[model samples]
Target: MDLLHTLTHRHTTKAYDTERKIPAPVVAQLLEALRYSPSSVNSQPWHFFVADNDAGKAQIAKATSSPFAFNASRVMDASHVIVLSARNTLPPEYLQTLSDQEEADGRYANADARAQAHKGRAGFVGLHEQAGDVPVWTQKQTYIAQGFLLLSAALLGVDATPMEGFDAAILSTELELAEKGLSPAVIVALGYHSDADFNARLPKSRLPEKSIFSHI
Candidate 1:
């Protein structure tokens, strides 16, 4: 599975081969992918809750919906479910250093990088307010890891469903993640596909790349 083909063929799989279960080690690799996902200034903010138990899976299934924004049974049918608990803060020391770097950049040098650094700094500062002064820049960082997870799974012949439609409160409880103040954003269901259980979804939809991009 070349990266390109894996990316192109990776569909939002709601129909999982219920009889098949994803191996534990493979799941570990997926998490590893996230663990190593790139972050701004290496502020990796992601916690993956992998649920393989029946009751747990049911809870996730009950909470989440599909990409098209529909409730899905296939969520519970997959071999495993993953929850992303992304904080909205960069590390304090990391923030401190970044702030220092900006101040130390001679006050007027390297306009592009400095501009990017400034905007990036602003983002970190904005998210800090979200986490009650805790830096939460890692939420966006986690998605980079997620991209790797999706691509890795696809290339490995595993199917996946990334879902954001769920009751965040309930999912937090089911995963016992609230104590850490971790918030749930999305759930990825993983396994092979079962044609019998397919959700009758239309093929993937998207806007044209030309419309989505522009060059100055």
Candidate 2:
């Protein structure tokens, strides 16, 4: 597949064909891509809440009212909406759970290796904790996963509209994410584009390579 072509062709879908729905198999691939997204020291500190039905989508759409009302249709009319959330805090138990999963998956050679790996991951988490930016740090990781989801959608011929315009606090309350120690980070709507999507015909804008990159 021509990745560059896909990158250039994929636009943020502004309108979706509500009548159409993504196949279950394709949705599975997009979620799987998010599951394996990279993070610092493999700190997978995010959760995804998928809304495939009207009721579920309505719950997410609650956050899109008023000033964010413009995004309401994007959330409600899409075939699916994924609410990406980050862990509110990096508790020790959570870190140990990650280590245990790694061990169970045969990622560690032995107990010593497991301990060393755990310590290394904890050390990095400690830096963010000390800086009091643990929430910020985890949110950044969620964005990485979001990137994976977006690219995977494009590759699967799915149009995606990632939105940070919704009210996060309202979304958290509606989804009860805080009770689960999670904070809403971003939302992505997935579906096929509708005839009203002007972005599909517009040119992509970006700075020239020389201005945005430097090679030694």
Candidate 3:
């Protein structure tokens, strides 16, 4: 695939074709991309809630009420909606769980290597905890996963809308994410765009690379 062409053509979808649905196989691939998304220290502190059915979508759409009403249709009409969430706190147990998983996955050649890996990741988590920025740090990682999902969707010929306009409190309550020690970071709607999507027809715009980049 032409990577530049894909990036240039991908746009945030506005209106979706309600009649269209993404094939299950394609959805699986998108989820895989999200699973492999990178995180600082390999913390992997995230959980995803996927909604494909009307009831589930409606539950998520509740958060888009009031000022965010504009995103309701995008949520309700899309083929799939994923609520990306981050851990409320990165407790030692959680960090240890990740360490154990890494060992199980053969990420370490020996016990000493495993211990060093855990120490490195825990040190970073400790720094964030001391700064009272654990939540912020984890949310940043969640957005990395969001980026992966959006790009993967684009590559699969699926339209995607990354939404941060929803009411977090409403979404957290509806999804009971807080009960699971998670908080909603973002929502992504995926489907095919409809004729009503004005954004699809607009040309892409951005500052020149020379203006945004600097060379040593």
Name the weakest run of 10 consecutive residues (lDDT summed) in model 3: 1-10
Clashing pairs in 3: none
Flag the better candidate by lDDT, 1 or 3: 3
For candidate 3, what is the TM-score?
A: 0.98
CA shift of 145, model 1, Å: 2.4
All candidates' lDDT scores? 0.71, 0.95, 0.95
lDDT string, candidate 3, 1-216, tens digits:
688989999999999999999999999999999999999999998999999999999999999999999999999999999999999898999999999999999899999999999999899999998999999999999999999999999888999999999999999999999899999999999999999999999999999999999999
Q: List the residue pairs that clash in candidate 2.
A: none
Q: Sort by lDDT, best first: what order?
A: 2, 3, 1
Model 3, CA-based lDDT? 0.95
lDDT of 1 by residue, 85-146 (tens): 88644445656565566568575356676667666766766566666745334566667777
Look at candidate 1 and give me any clashing residue pairs: 88-135, 88-136, 88-137, 89-135, 89-136, 89-137, 90-135
**Residue 159 CA displacement from its true place in model 1, Å:** 0.4
